[model samples]
Target: MKTYRYLDLITALFVVVLIVSNVASTKVVLLGPFTFDGGTILFPLAYIFGDVLTEVYGYKRSRRVIWTGFFLLMLAALTFGLVNLLPTPADPQSQGTAQAFSTILGLVPRIVLGSLVAYWVGEFVNSFILAKLKIATQGRWLWVRTIGSTLVGQGLDTGIFLLIAFYGVWDNSLLWTVFVSNYVFKVGVEVLFTPVTYAVVGFLKRREGEDYYDRDTDFNPFALGR
Candidate 1:
């Protein structure tokens, strides 16, 4: 087995971004004319990290990282669900605090399932597209690969998550609004952060001596053994 210096750090950051975004998703907020879950603010960064991982480490490693984030995210939701099931103290203050905790951290089964499924599918899509684009472009244009993948990947992520989590719960108009808003915002962030993505990719490739191309890789999301 081969190892790199920053792989662990990048994996750690990727998982952190995923878990935090899931937590933030409990609150819906409006930013200017856009209305979305608070997680929308930070969730896009996970794709950027996904781009970096696929661009530098290849899709195989990126698959491992994605699965790592997925499992950890599932564990977090389970943990919160467990805590929410525990009995609260009978004292008034304790009851209030407990209520707040449940309100904030209690994981809804539908939302949790939606989030996990969306992330798993969307990230794999993002990584697969970026990896293929990298090969197609011969690594010439980083911006195209990053933005292009985000366009499709984020679309799927937003649509899948929204439909699964809130299709019946939220007003149809509001759901459409958030869907459009999230897709645009996420893709916009990818475009705006192109320079940063290039810098990070360049640095990681240089430092780690790897600029992997998935030319002959399995491209399997569950093929973690290799």
Candidate 2:
């Protein structure tokens, strides 16, 4: 019912970053023998922001933001599909470029599906846990809620996304490796950023004059009406 001037804008930006990072995440480059997917670097921030949204704004508001992101991703996937389906120019060079675009964009469906599912589950878990912890601790120990929620939320997110996106494509061992690596990387990012999270949460609470408890809020992920 209520809207903040910058909430929608922030949600839009988060969604755009999520989509771009997912697309760019295909490559795992070595940083002096320490290898990591490029996406792993930026992807955890989305969760951090997600936690902030839910912790400060409540589940209803966070739900709207998450659904907005899901729809935006679907729109992006549809556009990619349409572009790939359209006929390329007669020039061989143009055709090659078109094919390359298709190769990159064609993976959108699986990636988007996995993303939507993982995001929905993981974010809700983070928020639900944070809200409960906030009440239980009477809003004390902010770091505990943030890091504790992330440990659970990021674990589910990494596992679900990898399993849904790459389960059968890679060998079992490789799949497990990716699962472990991504999970550790994401959770590590959350732990490292805990200080930043505390600062942001403090600032938002002070500025917004709101520290939502979600005492009477619904936790249903499918109830978009909230």
Query: Tens digits of per-residue lDDT for model 1 on 108-221?
Result: 899999999999989999999999999999999999999999988999999999999999999999999999988888888898899999999999999999999899999878
Worst 10 residues of 1 by lDDT: 217-226
Tens digit per residue, CA lDDT, model 2, 152-194: 9988987888778777877888767676777777888888998
The C-alpha local distance difference test score for the whole of candidate 2 amounts to 0.79
- lDDT to native, each model: 0.93, 0.79
TM-score of each: 0.98, 0.91
- Worst-scoring 10-residue span by lDDT in model 2: 28-37
Q: What is the TM-score (0 to 1) of candidate 2?
A: 0.91
Off by over 4 Å in 1: none
